[model samples]
Target: MVAAFNRFRLFHWLLAAFFLLAYLTGDGGELLHVWLGYGLIVLLALRVLLAPTKPRGFPSLAPARREWRKPTWAGVGKWLTFSTLVSVTLASVLGLGMVDNGEVVAAALPSVSIDVFGTRNWLGGLGDLENVHEFFANLALWMVGLHIAYILLFRSKSVMPMLRGLSPQGPGSAPKGRNHRQAPAWPALQVSSKVQETPDSCSFELTPPAGEAARFAGKPGQFLTLQVPCAEQPMARCYSLSRLPQPGQPLRITVKRVAGGRVSNWLVDNLQVGDSIQAMPPAGAFTLERTDADLLLLGAGSGITPLLAILQAALLHGEGQICLVYANRDEVSVIFAGELATLQQRYPQRLQVVHWLDRRDGQLNVPALVQAVQDWQQAECYICGPQPFSELAGQALADVAVPEQRIHRERYSGVEPAVAPPSPGRPSRVQVALNGQRHTLDVQPGEVLQDALDKAGLETPSACRSGVCAVCKCRVTVGSATMRSNQALSDRQVAQGWVLACQAEPDSAQLQVEY
Candidate 1:
């Protein structure tokens, strides 16, 4: 689900740009070109604010032809979206250029200096809109017709509110402490305390918070962003889930400390078993195929967590042979060893485990890995671990001709990830609401919100200060900021415009965030 949202975000961005170009060249107001982006930017912002809530109603896929909150000019939103979609399509058909500048122009009139389809212009000496453009023009016309039909079909229902993001689905879908929309308090939820999974990894389970924000949603291979507050400041980080996401079960995370990592070192050295830590719900794209096909699990180091969850699920219910080949620097670095041993003991015939150490094996041999999986040509493979190693293992699978459909992956990290929110420019400050105290920060250029808080002598919860850890995750109830990187977020967040404060900077005059 998270992955789907992430993919949708990419499309929204591109579509937004396209809309801007189309509006600029149209016969409409020139400000439409620039202001449209801002309005849609706000629209994207609203998407986040509104997503947490369920849509009050649907647009009646059964097109209505009646009075449904008029789509006339006063209904700016519907008009903008409909107009943009239609105009772009028409421009595409008329072979109207969408890009500005030489040989390309959008906003007002498409570029027709050289028509792909030989057709005469119909409008004055300016000529026709272009023949190739006709295809898209007709397509747009059909969409508008359909939209109108749907509205008329559902006459009394308001389509505008739905499109504008105006609903919140209560219960079932709204789990505890999972909401990014809720105000941030010292997160009240606590998962099960750390459990030693293997010498290298420890698991932390959680008790999701209450209300519409609580998180009861997660799938195997998904990840969570953590917020760890310090007496003097807060930090954030993102971690992949080692335990699969179950409906009512506690959210579980298995973390492995790496050499020279500040947050990892802190987690291993300072964190207590009973102490509570706040976090965003499990979110990520990697996971195992929840099917009864032959399965292969691969990992180079800690990356084995998500793959383990996948394997565990399959073993408990799935009926298929599961083969796992894991490589590490040494025996000590192999995660979930005891669990694997136990699994092997229980399902001796159905599961296989192969361990390799760089020191003993003289680095991983691609030929050996390829040979190991040669028997399971139809198996689905889930892999995770070190970066270069993950890349190499993925490459090895591909070189050996593993089908793309069969591969999924995950990564573990202490450093801030690059996946931050899409925001405007550097901010001068941020308003933090917590403990009933409002703290204002004077931000420096290139500094994340975490840094500013630290400078203010206020401690907020956080993990990886760089942004990978969501420990410093905050809610922007008002105003906007940019994410340092977006790797840690699922598509749901990037669209709603939630950014990692540890990596984001403000754009508006004053910004407010809930931590």
Candidate 2:
């Protein structure tokens, strides 16, 4: 996601730089103008080749849009960008033609003789090439001015991406990890220990084998995507680290059986200590960082895992007024029940535990939860759980006028990617570039790029194939691919042609992606 933003920023600035230099230099700066001409031609060619894959940030030139009487601001901006690109390209071509005449540019700059192979065959050897070049060059200049003015008008919100290659999202949809792009590669680690938290719930502690424990540092509330061996194929599942990280601590993840969950069920029933599993380094953005604010952690089922970690970290730092509203089906189903009770007894003055049970409480209701927490609006609420539970909790907090920025959440799964419409039976030719090598593979129209890469014997780092982790994001340099959904990318990133390979499928016949 971020890669696309950087590409756009780089391409945009390069075009502007060349255009300005070429215009100021004119033929008087013959050598400068000549090189600028070459640069602009290359830049425009790349832009045009990649235009089809551009985001829907601007209005389409298609006849289909003619029927719509109203035009969007986005469409207007798109039209402006497209117009400038076209004008500049035409100007560059005309300039090259004028250069081929050699006599005109050479005369203007007496100090330098501009020499290049003459190709008068282009544009039917137009006699008014210089005039045509000047007209479009001036036209492009005006459009560039307008574009700069537009950017200035919305610089605070839009320009930051150009500078930092990042655009902020609403706090409700916080991106996963603290710049997870730099995270280490997945490492093979053996499970060191396992403990039964409750019936149907188990916690596995992973450590680097031998003296490699130094390689396994992780923060609380982060998660490791473990590659587990199944009977047929390997299954990847993300589980939150349930314990706070210490110098010598083993990374722990808690898993509870879900009725139809293949990964969770397999993990709870089959995973054992001493078994080996491949694990991506710990990464996630939903961790407790602000200690001054009163903390409220809301979670249900295994969602309590990360919240539990945050709670322990907060308590260790002596943060006061911390509250936990943990919900479950029954007391018997609660994970870490004993540890939570011990924590409550230890910090009876500052910590509060309110348990909601389906058997007695008839499901956790929003109004009741709000009522139970007297300082609900004052607390920074960290929530995790099933989709329905999270949605309910978020709405409840919002209903009470709690600031959206104060609420953080992590979803293990459930976001359907923003993908292309189904075109069943169609085949796509995908070219993948990874670690300086390129490979080609045929993907079914609806198949994700990662699957095709795997078939071609290439490894593309990924976690949470649903697109939340963003570890699989790759830049599409040619053709187009669409993500089914995205929580990782900013709008600017998507505009620049970044797609989550695990969640993206090609919409064009041939696509080129780089990792």
Task: Name the top TM-score candidate.
Answer: 2
Q: Locate the minimum summed-lDDT window of 10 residues in model 2.
A: 58-67
Provide the lDDT at 463 for model 2: 58
lDDT of each: 0.60, 0.72
Tens digits of per-residue lDDT for model 1 on 1-515?
A: 32333344345545555554654476664345434544455545555465433122111111112214333332333443455454543453233233232222233346544443234333334344444455554555555455566566653254433344433232112233433332244454565577766665677777677662445466666666676664356666666677766666777777777676665656656666667787766655565434445688887777777787788877764556889999888877777788889999998988999898888887786677777767766667777776677677777788778776567655444464554443445557677887667988777656677668877777566545555534456678788777756455544455566677667777666788875
Worst 10 residues of 1 by lDDT: 58-67
* Residue 442 CA displacement from its true place in model 2, Å: 10
What residue pairs clash in candidate 2, if any at all?
A: 59-75, 177-284, 177-285, 417-484, 417-485, 418-483, 418-484, 418-485, 419-483, 419-484
Tell me the deviation in Å of residue 188 in model 1. 3.0
Which tens-of-lDDT digit does each residue in 1-515 have in candidate 2? 34464566567667666666767765577667766677778866665565454322211223123223555664455556667777777887877766554554566567555553455436656777777878998988888888777777754476666566654442223234332323345578777899999898899988866655554566678777676675486666678889987777678899888777777788878878888788766666676755434688989999999998899887775334788998999999999999999999997877899899999889777788778764768777888898889888888888888777677877645322245665767788888776677888898977888777776666567655656556788889999987776655645567889888888888899999887
Sequence-dependent TM-score of model 2: 0.55
